[model samples]
Target: MHEVSIMQDMLQLAEENLRKSGCTEIRRISLRVGLLSGVVPEALSFAFDVLKSGTSAANATLEIESSPSLFSCGACGTESWYESLRFECPECHGILILQKGGTDLELTQMEVSSTD
Candidate 1:
């Protein structure tokens, strides 16, 4: 599954950031996953279970934040929630511009312990 690769990459990046930040141990990884980001938390968690072995984030908790999809009309500049696949704006029949809420896979914060 793609989640496996996603986890592998996320772990690798987390390890680097943790090292850069001088964290000896990580307690949790906070991620902001957009609804349209095309990622499944369950699958990612499963991947993390195996991929985190012997790594800095080993056994670390994964916290996911849900982000909703927002859209703006290009013609009328009207903004609203985009819950459907159809991008047509309800007001002006304009093309919907997907806003920044969804389609993001960002690493928001990390909880780590000092190396001591």
Candidate 2:
């Protein structure tokens, strides 16, 4: 799946950062996944498990923080959380537009140990 490629890229970035920081072990890789990012968390976790072997992140834990999809009412200027594809505003029954957040897959933080 595409998650494999995504994990590969994440691992590459982690490795690069580890090298730059003189770190030999990665303890955690924290990610922020948006509801509308189109990336499956289960698949991404499986890919990380399968691909981490023998790498700097072999023992790393993948921590995912899910971000809910949010929308703003075009007519009322009200914002709310949404889990479905509904684009109707709850307050004024106006058309809802995506205002902030969601639709993103980002690496937020990493915990690592130096080679020392």
Candidate 3:
């Protein structure tokens, strides 16, 4: 799947950052995945597991933080969280638009061991 490519990119970035910091071992890779990011967490994890072989992140744990999809009412400026594709304003029954968060895949932090 595409998650394999995504994990490869993430591992590349992690390795580059770790090398720059003089770190040789990665402990964890923390990611924030939005509900609408179109990236499946389980698939991503499986990709990482399969792709980490012989890399610095082979032993690294992949930590994913799930973000909920949020929408704002166009007519009333109200915000609501939903899990499905339907978007309806609960406050004023107005059309809901995506205001903040969701549809994002971000690497928040990486825990590594620097060997001096």
The sequence of per-residue lDDT tens digits that candidate 3 reaches over residues 6-71 is: 889889989998989887899899988888888999999999999998998989999998877778
Residue-level lDDT of model 2, residues 9-110, one tens digit each, is: 988998898888887999899888887888998999999999999998989999988877778888998888875566888788999998667787988899
Candidate achieving higher lDDT, 1 or 3? 3
Q: What is the TM-score of each candidate against the true structure?
A: 0.72, 0.81, 0.80
Q: By TM-score, how accurate is candidate 3?
A: 0.80
lDDT of 2: 0.87
Candidate 2: segments with Cα more than 4 A from true spot? 81-95
Give each model's whole-structure lDDT: 0.81, 0.87, 0.86
Runs of candidate 1 exceeding 4 Å displacement: 71-79, 82-100
Extract clashing residue pairs from model 1.
Answer: none
Provide the lowest-lDDT 10-residue window in model 2. 82-91
| Cα-lDDT of candidate 1 | 0.81
